[model samples]
Target: MTTTLQINGRPVAVTAEDDTPLLWVLRGELRMNGTKFGCGKALCGACTVMLDGEAVRSCATPLAAVQGRAVSTIEGVKGPEIDALRRAWTELDVVQCGYCQSGQLMSACALLRHTPKPSDADIDAAMSGNICRCGTYPRIRAAIHLAAGDDRR
Candidate 1:
């Protein structure tokens, strides 16, 4: 099936199987590799992307489900919120291995978008699904807080 999607404020058209995961369409067909394929299961958030501005596991999300919706990959992250978060990520050295950072950042971006001011627990709750094997939890929390303070909210 050929589907047209509004991704990152842009309209994209893809032709593939109906059940093809969004991740493959984005990375393979669309050439958007920012979203990773970790466990392929929804258990790992390594393939997180923003569907209509909400964090979602693209690896398990069917392309048909998001055909008419907007999908935002890590590459599509922009504006004040993303810029602030990226700076904080770098300044705090929040990434250890970096394979999971894209998903981590996507989740953080969603959390900050909804809650301009979030508590440690809020951060924990939102970020619990995204795992960083290098154990940068402390730094990630700190950076989220720091970036939240600079909210364009």
Candidate 2:
């Protein structure tokens, strides 16, 4: 099946099965490798991407679900919030191994989009699903606050 999708504000056509995971389609078909494959199951947030402005697990999301929907991968994430996130991630040194940072950033973007000035509890709740083996949660939280212009330590 040829699934037409809106990716990063561009229309892209992908030839894949309806059941094909969006991760594979993005990585294999579209050659967008920013979204990583972690647990394969939805438990890991390493394959997180934005589906119609909401953070979703691309590894588990079917291609059919994304057809005609707007998808934003790490490669396509833009805007001031994302720029602020990138700066914060760099300044705070949030990435250790860096395998999970893309998903972390995506999730953070979604959180900030919804709650521009999130509390500690809000950050905790929003980031609970994204697990960083390097345990950089403190830096991640701080970076999110910095991106939001909170900068409260």
Candidate 3:
């Protein structure tokens, strides 16, 4: 079947079964490989993408479920928030193997976008679902603070 979904600020038409995971259409069909496949389950946030501005695991989210919805991948995070986050990620040295950093930044960007000045507990709650095998939790927290412009400001 054919499906239409908004992605990365652009409308994309895809021909796939309704049950086809959005991750496949993203990486396979659309050729957007930023979203990685880790567990192929929602347990891993490697496939996290913003659906209507909220992070959703694209691995488990079927294409049909996202039809007509705006999906923002790491590739689409533009302007100030992402700029700050990306800079903070570098400044804080948040990436290890670099596999999980995309998802981490996506979640962090969302948190900073909404909360702006999230506390430690708020940062923990927002980032709890995303797991980094490199154990970059401390750096992640530091990066969040740096991105929020809360560090040394």
Candidate 4:
């Protein structure tokens, strides 16, 4: 099947099976590797991407579901929220293994977009699905807060 999706900001047409995971389309067909594959079960946020400005797991999202919809991967994400996240992430040394940072950033970007000033509880709830084996949760939280100009740390 051929599906045309608005990736980042440009329209991209890709050919794949209807049920093929969006992850494969991005990584395999499109040669975009920013989104990682961790569990392939959608349990991990490593495959997270923005679908119309909302974070969705590409591993579980099928090609048919994203046809003609806007999809933003780590490679294409930009703007104030993402810029703040990148700065805070780097300034706070939020990355350890670096496998999950893209997913974490994507999720965090969504959180900031929805809640410009999120509480600790909100951060926890929004980031609960993303797992960091390196145990950088504290730094991640601090980075989010910093990105939001909270400075609660």
Candidate 5:
């Protein structure tokens, strides 16, 4: 089937079966590799992407489900919150090994978009789904707090 999705504010078309995972469509068919594949079961947020402004695991999401919907990957994430998050991630050294950073960033972006100023509990709840095998949860939470303009020093 031919599916057209609004990705990162641009319309993209791909041909695949309805059951084809959105991750493969983004990585293989569309050649957008920023979204990683950790666990295909959606338990891992490595494949997280914003679907209509909410983070969804692309590895388990079907291409057909995203048709006509806005899907924002790490490559597509933008705006002031994203900028702040990126800066915080960089300045605070949030990445270690870098495999899960994309998903972490995507999840963080969604959290910031909705919460703006999240407390530690909020940050923890928001990021609970994203697994950073590097064990950077502390740094990740700090980055989210930093991005929210919270003084974590």
Candidate 6:
């Protein structure tokens, strides 16, 4: 089957099985490798992507589910929120292994979009699902705080 979805800001059609996970289509068929595959299960947020401004696990999301919806991967996500996150990530040195940074950034972008000034607890809740093997949770939280303009750290 063929499904068309808005990626980043562009609309593109991909031909794949209806149940094909969006992650495979992204990294395989579409050649959009920014979204990584950490686990086939949705337990890992390594495959997180924005589905209509809400982060979803691309590893478990089917292509058919995203038809006509806007999907924003790390490569395509843009705006003031993401820009601030990028700056904060760099300034705070949030990346460790770097494998999970894309998903981490995507989830952080969504949090900032909904809650521009998130407290530490809010950051913890928003980012709890994303696991970094490098144990950069402290830096990740600090980066979110910095991106949200809440530099109380």
Q: How do the predictions measure up, each by TM-score?
A: 0.94, 0.98, 0.95, 0.98, 0.98, 0.97
Tens-place lDDT per residue, model 1, 1-153, is 788888888998899898999999999999988899999987778999998778999989998889778888898787677898999989888888899999999999999999988998899999988878888888988999989884322
Q: CA RMSD for every model?
A: 2.6, 0.7, 1.4, 0.6, 0.8, 0.8
Provide the overall lDDT of each model, using Cα atoms, as 2-decimal numbers: 0.88, 0.93, 0.87, 0.95, 0.92, 0.91
RMSD of 4: 0.6
Candidate number that wins on TM-score, 4 or 6: 4
Task: Return the candidate ranking by lDDT, descending.
Answer: 4, 2, 5, 6, 1, 3
Candidate 1 residues lying further than 4 Å off, grouped into runs, are: 150-153
For model 1, give the 10-residue run with minimal summed lDDT: 144-153
Q: Which candidate leads in lDDT?
A: 4
What TM-score does candidate 2 reach? 0.98
How many clashes in each candidate?
A: 0, 0, 0, 0, 0, 0
- Candidate 6 lDDT tens digits, 1-153: 777889999998889998999999999999998888998898879999999999899999988899888999999899999999999999988887899999999999999999999988888888888989999999999888888888776
lDDT for model 5 comes to 0.92
| Candidate 3 TM-score to native | 0.95
Residue 32 CA displacement from its true place in model 4, Å: 0.5
**Could you tell me the lDDT of residue 91 within candidate 3?**
81
In model 2, pairs of residues that clash are: none
lDDT of 5 by residue, 1-153 (tens): 787889999988889999999999999999999999998999879999999999999999988799879999999788998899999999999898999999999999999999999998998898899998889999998888898999784
* Candidate 6 local Cα displacement, residue 70, angstroms: 0.5
Worst 10 residues of 3 by lDDT: 144-153
- Candidate number of the best TM-score: 4
